[model samples]
Target: MRTWNDSLKIGIPLLDCQHEQLLDQMDQLLEAMESQKGEQELRAIMGFLKMYINNHFNYEESCMALYKCPVACNNKDAHAKFLITLQDINHKIELKQSLELIVTQVKQELLDWFVNHIKSIDTRLQSYVKKSE
Candidate 1:
């Protein structure tokens, strides 16, 4: 199960909720792959995951902008790279690439990025919020 530990909190309620939803989608994808789900079901999930991520990332970054987070631009670039990588993942899935490899690679990369971004970059934004208040 994906976690929503306190350390992941960025003091933004909406962003935190979206983060939980994204993690839940990731968990569902992992479970589906482990069970060898069919293409149709996977496609449904991919559709939701793609749109949800796009929406979440865009909105969260906009929050940073409103807060005048200095790291917002840098964070947005990282988000862009992630979106590009997600597109590549979609391509690989469409081509029937090894599900195990794809799941492992994607999950690990995602978790690593989440941890690093939350611990370093997101925390910087939190500090900015604190300082601004």
Candidate 2:
């Protein structure tokens, strides 16, 4: 179970905290799924993640645009795509897909995409912020 650490920080305290919380929630979602927790619990975590991700992405996108970060366009496109993927996952859940399938998708799509996005695009944003500062 991967956990948040300083290495994931993009030099923005608010976004960093949001990222940490997102990662923590992802872990809990995975744990609950693997432990065979109830559907209600899973839905609760999913609901929080859905809302939090939107807020986080909006703030991040605005910051990137305000800072004139080079990756701003890419960041926006990525966020849009992620939102679509999340919507698909939610649809699957509503359709009552198997828990194992949902877990796999969450791990592969949400968790993996998030870490990669942070390491690659968000790191570039951090560099821009540093230069601007």
lDDT score, residue 24, model 1?
A: 77
Alpha-carbon RMSD, candidate 2:
1.2
Candidate models: Cα lDDT each = 0.80, 0.89
Q: Which candidate is the best by TM-score?
A: 2
Candidate achieving the largest lDDT: 2
Please identify model 2 stretches exceeding 4 Å from their true place. none
Write model 1 residue lDDT over 1-133, tens digit each, in one string. Answer: 6655777877877777887787778778778888999988778888898999999888879878988998999999989988887788788889999999988867777656666777777666776667777
Alpha-carbon lDDT of model 1: 0.80
Residue-level lDDT tens digits of model 2 in 1-133: 7668889998899999999999999889889889988889888988999999999999999999988898999999999999999888878877878979988998999898999999999988887787778
Over 4 Å off in model 1, which ranges? 131-133
Model 1: how far residue 81 lies from native, Å: 0.6
